[model samples]
Structures are given as C-alpha cells and as structure tokens.
Target: MTRQMIIEPAGQAGLTAERVREVVAAHPAVAAHLGAADPGRLIVGGAAVTGRDAAGDAAGRAPFRASVFDPVANRGVELRGTVAAPERAEVAPSAWRPTPGPDELRAAAQILRADPRFPASGDVVVYQPMPPLADLERPDGTTTRRPTLGLYTPGEDVEHRIVAVDTAAGTVDWSPAGVSPAMHPGDCESHLPEPVESLRDRGGPDAVRLRVLDGGTELWNLIVVRPRASAPQNPGDGSGVELREVRHRGRLVFRQAHVPILNVQYEEDGVTFRDWQNQETRFSATGTDPVGWGWRICTRPPRTILERPDNDAGNFQGVAFHDAGGEVRIVSEIAAGWYRYVSEWRLADDGTVRPRFGFAGVRNPRTCMRHRHHVYWRFDFDVEGSDNDVIEQFDEVAPGVLKATPILRETSRRRRGTARFWQVTDAASGRGYRIVPGGHDNTADPYGIADLWFLRRRASELYDGNPDGDNRAMLDRFVDGEDIGRTNVVVWYAGHFRHDQNAPHPHQGHIVGPNLVPVR
Candidate 1:
C-alpha cells in the first residue's frame, strides 16, 4: 500500500508534548486523569493546523499541512491514505454566474480600507471563494437558500467579521464575530474575540473553500462549502425553497446549514465532573472565576509549511500543498487557571480537513485528578441538499474483499464499538460523503460511547448533548427523542483523549476528529 500523507513539520515553532504535560499536571484533580499512561506519552494539548501565506508570492503557491507540534499528527490520526483528489465533475458552476474574480476581491478590500470600522492593515487577507459562491436562506419557506458572495475578514481592532456582498443588488452585509448562529467557544475561550487568519480554496478546480479563523484566542472552524451551478437557487428576494434552482450570482453566504455544530466537553473524576458552563468556562482549576467573555489574549503570528503527497496524481499534477490553514497560540489564563490554547485548522485540496485543539500555559496547582476531553462536534450536512440521512457501513474483513451496507442504527453515550465508519447520505440523489473519525475508537476517550450519533435536524437541537456548556449530567439530552430515519439530520461525533502527565518532548498532542471525504 502507498504511504498516506502523514501531517508533520512545524508551520511555526510548536509546543513540545512535555510542555503540554507540565500544564496538565498543574491541577491534581485534572492531573489525576493521567493515571500513568507513561510520563511523556500523554500530551495534554497541541494542534495540527494548515498555514497558507497571503494571496500572492511563490511561498503561497501550494498549500501546507501545519501543526503546533514540529511533526504534527505523528501520533493521533486515522485516515485512508490517498493523496489523489477527486476528478472535476463534468458539470460546473455557471461561467455566466456572478463568481467573485480578483477584481471583486480587490474592490472589497478597498471598501474595507476606507471604512471607519476597519483596523489598519498590517497583515492583509484577501481570498477567492473555492466553491466560488454561497447560498443564504430566507424566513419564508418558499426558498430555503439564497445565493451570495461570501468573504472572511477579522475586522479592524481585533473584532471579527464576515463580509457577504449581494452580487445581485451590489449591497453588502457585515457580521461581527461571536454573534448567534456562530460556533460556541470553549470554556476557557468565551472571553476572547475569534480571529480569522486566512481564507482560501484548495483542490484547484472543484476545490473546497475553507475559512481559518480564531476565537478569543482559542476556537476556529474548517467550514467546507461546495460551489456548483446545481446549488439551490434564489431570486435575491426574501422568500422561497420552492423556486427553481439557479447558478445565480453569489448573493448569500449561508453557514448554520452547511457546517456541523461541535462542542468540546472535558471531565474528570470518572466522567462525574465537568469544567465549563453557561456559555463560558465556569471556573479555573485554580479557583472559581469571574465574568470574562472579552478577555485579552496574546496570539502569536502564524507560520507556514508545505506538503506534496506521495500519491499525487490526476489533476494535482504539479501542485505542491501550500499552507492553506491558520496556526497560532492563544495564551490567556486560558483554562485550568494558566494554560495556552494552541489552536490549528487544516484544509487539504483533496477535501480532507482537520481541526486540532492543543493546550499550554500554566498547570493546575490543585489536586492531581484524571480527566478526559470530549469534542461533541455537531454537523449539519447540507451536501447539495439540507435533507439527508446517515449510512453506517462496515469494513467487513474477508478474503480479498470488503463489503458494506446501511442499517437502522441505535446510539448510546455510555457504550462503544459500533459501525467503524459512516456517511451523511442524501436519500434523494442517493448522494453524500462519509465522515470517518480519525485515530482509533475511543479516539476521544476510552469510556465514551456512541462514537457517532445521527438525529433528524431540529431547531431545538442547536447545541451539544449538553448545551449550557454545563455538566455531563445533560450529556445525552440531544439524543433522547431524536430520530434519524430518512430526514434532514445532524451528525454528532465525540472525539477525545484521557489526560495524564505530558509525554516527552518529541511526542505529539492528541488529535481526534473525522477525516471528511467528499464521496463521488
């Protein structure tokens, strides 16, 4: 078998696993979670993020798979190693449609340059839409989505913003970071503004447009949007899902629908304890904390890396993987009292994405307790359509053969060992792709259950099994009455790791999440 593309090399100077353990060992209660996994084998926090230089420059020519660890993902990672990207489908987004060319992007930049609200530019960020367009949904049921030109800018003075221009009317809409419909920030992270470092497209022709942004110096997302002429159409009017589909000019950039929702849960004392609550991290391992949603975090400058997979073939003929993500260390009295949140996100040209969470800073000086972190990632798969279902398939081992199929599935947060992998499949077009969890089962925690949970989409199902960012008591609240049979559903994936002492210097942080593959 050909070797898989193992993400390694430092994009910028990275944190050592030993450093991570030092912080993990700070609090006894939190430290006790380590329970002897070996001194230098359990890294508490580090990340594997992608780094892309600005729009121009030879350094930015190809994309790069970056990490906080010098050689990231040398440890935790699970993916079918294939560097070959998909063949550009015969059909494409309309050439006549209003896709943003460099001219539009430059124009947008100039507009921001003169805006009173914009921060003075130092490191400027300009991007081209990968899917090359976006769809926004209206309140009326007639049309569920609208077309628009979507763009990402961190905003002036550290505030965050998303710029979406109505390609039809030439009007623009600006959204501040940390607003509702925005991803929830982690416990230690609620107090800081999310910083978006860069936005770029990978995979050439039919590339996935990825947004690499930072939060309160801690959170970020790998938002993947597939641009095509077949996307749901809109008249730029505020109504209709029933209207005919069109390759309309990019008008609306709708997210809350396409990307999944994810929550990071950390607990110790045998899953009976939790560390975050009420849209904020309740208290620090040091002591009970106070109000802090706008705390200051010193975020380091991002670095870059490059990757050229061994199996590079097809359309990736001579493309070198340029840095296409953002990697920066956000240090606040982050959590566990004094720790750093090394956040990283990588989007490859082959439709593979990784979101890694790493921690540094001071350790808990209290009890040495054992603990685990569970990232309950909620995904709303709007793959060409919002209404889709789950398909659990097994890699049935046989003599020179592998078999797969779908079945009525059940879920539990207290058990393990279910379907090895699954996908968000559209029942209508019989289309959709697989969501494969990386690393091994218990990739997140040995005691966690129902690695993958599927439920029909519901307004009430906005947060994680536990939304308040509260206790593990309400952990499975989202799974109680939800069903996943032939309906628009969200996929919740729990990826975590047990924290003990930090492993050795050369060790890597625990990276867990799914390697998203767009199924043909």
Candidate 2:
C-alpha cells in the first residue's frame, strides 16, 4: 500500500543547491556530527547511491534518483532533469551559515569514531533535515518550521544503526540497534509488499502511480501504502508486482490501500495498552533554536521500514524512502517529560517496516522491579480495498487455546513457532494479504489465550482496552456479536516476553511489532 504525494518534472523540483545549503548551514553541528564516521562515505554518500539500477552496475546500489537514500551523500538533493553534470551535489558553505567550519565538522566526526558500538562494517551517512511537520503533519495536520537531522549507518548485514541528536540540547540517544551483525530486523520484511517501482518504470509515458507514506500510529509509527487504482500485474494468480490497473488513457489510478502499514499493541502487567499513556498518538515539541518553532521530527526520512538482509536475494531485501529536505538529522525526540521514548521508524526498499520503541528516562524515583514490557501490533488490512474480508489460517499443528477451541503450543519460552495466521482477502476479487505474528505467540503461558483474532473494522473500536482496567471485557464485547462474513476487518496479533530485572534501562531497549504479508 502506498500514498503518492507530489509529482513534478525534474526541472520544477523546487529544491536547489542554494536552498539546500541554507538548511544544512543552519545545522552545522549535525552536519559536523558525523560520529567517528565514513569520510569517503561522507563525501560520496554510500556505495548504494551509485545509480546501479541495471545488472552491469555494482551490487547494493539503487538508482541515483530523488530518494531519501540518495540525499545523505549528495548535497541534500537527489538530482533530476536532463542536465547531469555532477552526479551529485554537496552543501558548500554559503554566507547564510558561518557557524559550521572545518574544525567543528572534525569535532563532530569524532563522536562516531569514539563510540564502541559504532559499526566498523557500515557506511555512516548524514542525510538532510526535514521540517518537524515531516513527522507531525496528518491528512489535515498543521505544518511546522523546525527541522531535525537523520543519521544513518547502512550496515553490511541485516541490522544498521540510527542515532538521534538534539541540536538544541546537544544530547544524542540511539536505539539498542547498535552495530552487531547478529541484530537483524527479524520477520519485519517477510510480510509487506515489495518496492515494485524498482521493477517497472515510474517515469516516461508508462509510469505507475504509487505512494509510500511514513504515517503515525498508537504505540508505534507507521508506513502506510495507498497505491490507489492499481492492480497486481498478474491478476489471475496474485503472483505479480502491483502494476497500475490500466484503463484506456489519460487516467492512472490504484486502490486506496495496497496494504495497511502497521498497527501496534503494548501489553504488560495483565493490562493491554495501545499508544501513549492516554492514547496520545500524535506528538509535538519546540526546538531550542532561536526562532522557537514547533517541530515533528519523527516524520523525517531514511524511513527504512525493515532492517538490512542476511541473504543477497533482491526480493527479500526490503525498501524504504524518506524526504529529508537537505539537512542531516539522525534521531527525533520529545523532552520536558519524565520518560523519553525515542521513536525510530524505518522502511526498507522491500515493504518491510518497523516502528521501534526505545524507552528511556525514569518511570519512578526508586527501585525498579522485574517485570515484562509486552508488545504486539494490530495489522489492520484491506487486501484489494476497503470491502475486503479476512479468515483465520493456520498450519497442521492444531493450535492450543485458553478456554477456547484450538490452542497452539510454544516450542519453548523463547521459541513460539508460528502455527497461526490471519488471511485478509478482498471479497470481490478474492485478492488479499496475510497478517502473521512477528515471532512468538503467548499461548504457552496459561494467562495467554489467543495469538490472533479477526474482527470487523469500526472507528470507535480502535484500542483493545479503554481507560478502565477491564480491557479484556472490551475484547469480549467486540467479539460477542459481530458480522464475520463479507465485511471489513482488523487482525489483532501479539508478541511478548517478561522483561527481567537485569534488563538494561535508560541504556537498553527492545524492538516489537507484527508483519502484514501481501498474499499472492
């Protein structure tokens, strides 16, 4: 599912090197904060931006078009139009910004070099910063003036690195996704759709209309897809890239939702919760800069949903794109509060995406206990469109249950082999997708009952629990009586584990969510 925003000729792309420099020069510290970095990667971006769209081209590279991945190396712009003199551009020091000098850049670069966790196998990139509205702006949401840097550490293997630095606070914090080959974006990309445009031309006369959006959600951030009015290239079988369902001419359209990006759940202490403490999904903060404008930093790019890939299989490696209007900002944060949950969202070239919740700061003034921070995600899906239906699909294991029909047993406390699934299909065309649990299901625990359930969609039925502690009652109420046939539905999937007392805090964190696979 993708949402196409603005499309204009390369020449009328509105962004210029001068304007790009204005944004970068304004945040010279971020530009300088390369983090003990990739000097060569700093100069030429990463090898991935070398414009390797064809076979003869080098490996791991993408077309040098106007993409979020291309901005870090270039001068915050992905060059377009006919005249291609310099393959890329750099933000040369203009009169507008005098604070950032060679010495300052050298100092910032030291930060990366000094970190023990900084990956030696990855390329460090300082991408452009986008206005805060990049994160906060909804369909009718307000615009913002403040911006943040997006630091990317494109690693050699599956998991990469991302660190958010507050220019105003000069404070930097990162997800535990610290450099480690073993840390892969687990089951993240296995479900979502592929970056099909990579297969077909999105330009010239026969381009397909597609949009990949970095949207907001209750507990986690989202990457919503709205490739309206398009259909699978291979319609009869469902085994094909989502191509524009061609009509005659002068009209190119796709369905409203190719797929519902993500819906997350946070379950802990026998109480299931979604979003913030009071269901506050949206966030706002004022930058410390002199102007003091409000900003939504979470919306910035390198919106890479999934982590990297262990195997080089082209289809398996995920895809992600973000628009960083030319200043490099790594992480986005919220302040003036007791706890800071650095919201880091990534979208891969493949459709795999994840919204990591990095919980920091103190919850209490005293002793912390050995408890679990359980997490789950409700992947609301529409296979072909809004009128789609869903069914429960499972393997031969014969799922075990909690006072229910069938129950699937967990292999171990750590291993919950996926024997459960929910298939969402379009009733009209019979085309749909599958929503699978990311890793483990909680059936083994006596308290844990069902891992997945199918329910019709409703505006008021967003959360599994309300203000009261009796959330399970809400679930019972929604399930007691509802139409399960020929209607829209949302698949609620969960994953959890007990956070032991040894769990690192104000230091370490966890990545939790589910996956929505487009079923061919």
| RMSD in order of candidates | 23.6, 20.0
The estimated TM-scores of all candidates read: 0.39, 0.36
Per-residue C-alpha lDDT of model 2 across residues 1-520, encoded as one tens digit per residue? 3332222111211223334333333433334433233322322211112221222333423332221111122122223311132233332321110112122233333454455755564444432111111112226553211122234343334332334332222334443122212222322212122211122212121112223332321111222211211111100001001122211111111121121111122233232322222101112222221111112222434222122222111221111223333211222321111122233333332333333333332222111333333333344454555544646455535546412122221111222454455555666675555545554233423333345556666644443433343322134345645666666666555444444334552222344445544444
lDDT against the true structure, per candidate, is: 0.32, 0.30
User: What stretches of model 1 exceed 4 Å from their correct place?
Assistant: 1-322, 325-336, 366-368, 407-418, 440-447, 464-470, 473-475, 480-483, 502-506
Any idea what lDDT model 1 has? Answer: 0.32
**What's the CA error at residue 480 for candidate 2, in Å?**
1.6
Model 1: per-residue lDDT, tens digit, 282-371?
A: 111111111122211212222211011121011211011223233222111112212222223344433443544443322122112334
